[model samples]
Target: MTEETHLNPTQPVNQQIYRILRRDIVHCLIPPGTPLSEKEVSLRFDVSRQPVREAFIKLAENGLIQIRPQRGSYVNKISLNQVRSGGFVREAIERAVVRRAAILVTDAQLYQLEQNLNQQRTAIDRHQLNDFFQLDDDFHQILCDIAQCRLAWETIENIKAAMDRVRFMSLDHVTPHEMLLEQHWAIFRALEKHDEQLADETMHQHLAEISASVLLIRQENRDWFTEEQ
Candidate 1:
């Protein structure tokens, strides 16, 4: 595993470590089934073992790692069931959110969506994959907010961790970011026109791509997935 580049002294050490490890795991930098050592991670980050242990606990809670009593902690392989379950929840909530957003969105909120799309284009042009991914998330989040369903967005966040890992793996391999951007545009248009049916259909199509990508990725990286999947 690569050492974290820098740590902010002001922030909580465990949270920082958790975020770094989470990003690496999600991006497949630390491949599935690789053992993690508290000692090594602590030394690498120049922090104490306590923070590393705390970080591991958080990672395990997020389904990114498996902690064995005596064996060791290892990055958990992707579960196909979790991916499907997450996708189902995401689609159900987002479809409804978009439908309501189509009816409730205002001109200012529409402009915000436009600005987000412009930033996404800039991120793509600059080859900033991470930035593009964040923007993509923000786009859907904004729609949820516009629909006055902040609670729904919170639920989606909790359930989408598995789908997020799949998305990270899909980037630059199974799907192009531009294609995702286009889908966002379609959804944006639907909201602009206040077409609930169109919004619902577009949201469904957009999220369905994740399932297709998961199938392709599983074939390519079999070891990264669980046997039970």
Candidate 2:
């Protein structure tokens, strides 16, 4: 809830609003438990309340916010159960994705993965957390593409919101970027050699980091998480 930001005139207003708001939520820009006013968000984006309402509905569906009819809407606190469950599903899906990628990946696709790793390293060195986060996602997305299963990435995206918040927090606190980078390298090497088992195992270890780091993250940012665990 700050000054108005420009929006793409070509894109659907509601989707633009949703993506921006989603990114803000995931990055903790609008920290958990913060009240969200439809009018304020509309003013911030220089849009009508209808689109903002639509975005809010989508956010609610994603469990990033709670909209109470008689009361008001607020960003939902991270649910530990949701994060752990999401991580579990993500690991199961991505382990399979990496294994398939190992069998199907081409030299060109492997080079793309290598480039992403390079960008990740540069982002870390420059302390560009946002850039590194995007690179990290792109690395996984590329794997799904190589596996010829775009729907797999789509499925992960839907369930990964809560997990993403903790991931952002972990990156800022306990988790080291270098550690994640090494894991990516391990996965990439397995894919390069077409080793399905190694690819699956490395991907499991990589995705499991979120679960492993969540307890420490919740301890550090206690207010950001729900007590309902």
Q: Where does candidate 1 clash, by residue pair?
A: none
Per-residue lDDT of 83 in model 1: 90
**How many steric clashes does model 1 contain?**
0
Over 1-229, each residue of candidate 1 has an lDDT whose tens digit, in order, gives: 5565589999999999988998888877898889999998988899889999999998887688899989889999988888998899889899989999999999999999999999999999999998998899899899989999899987887677677888988988688998999999999999999999999999999999998999998999888887443
Least lDDT summed over 10 consecutive residues: which range in candidate 2? 1-10
CA lDDT, every prediction?
Answer: 0.89, 0.90
- Predict model 2's lDDT versus the native: 0.90
Index of the highest-lDDT prediction: 2
Scored against the true structure, residue 178 in model 2 reaches a CA lDDT of 93
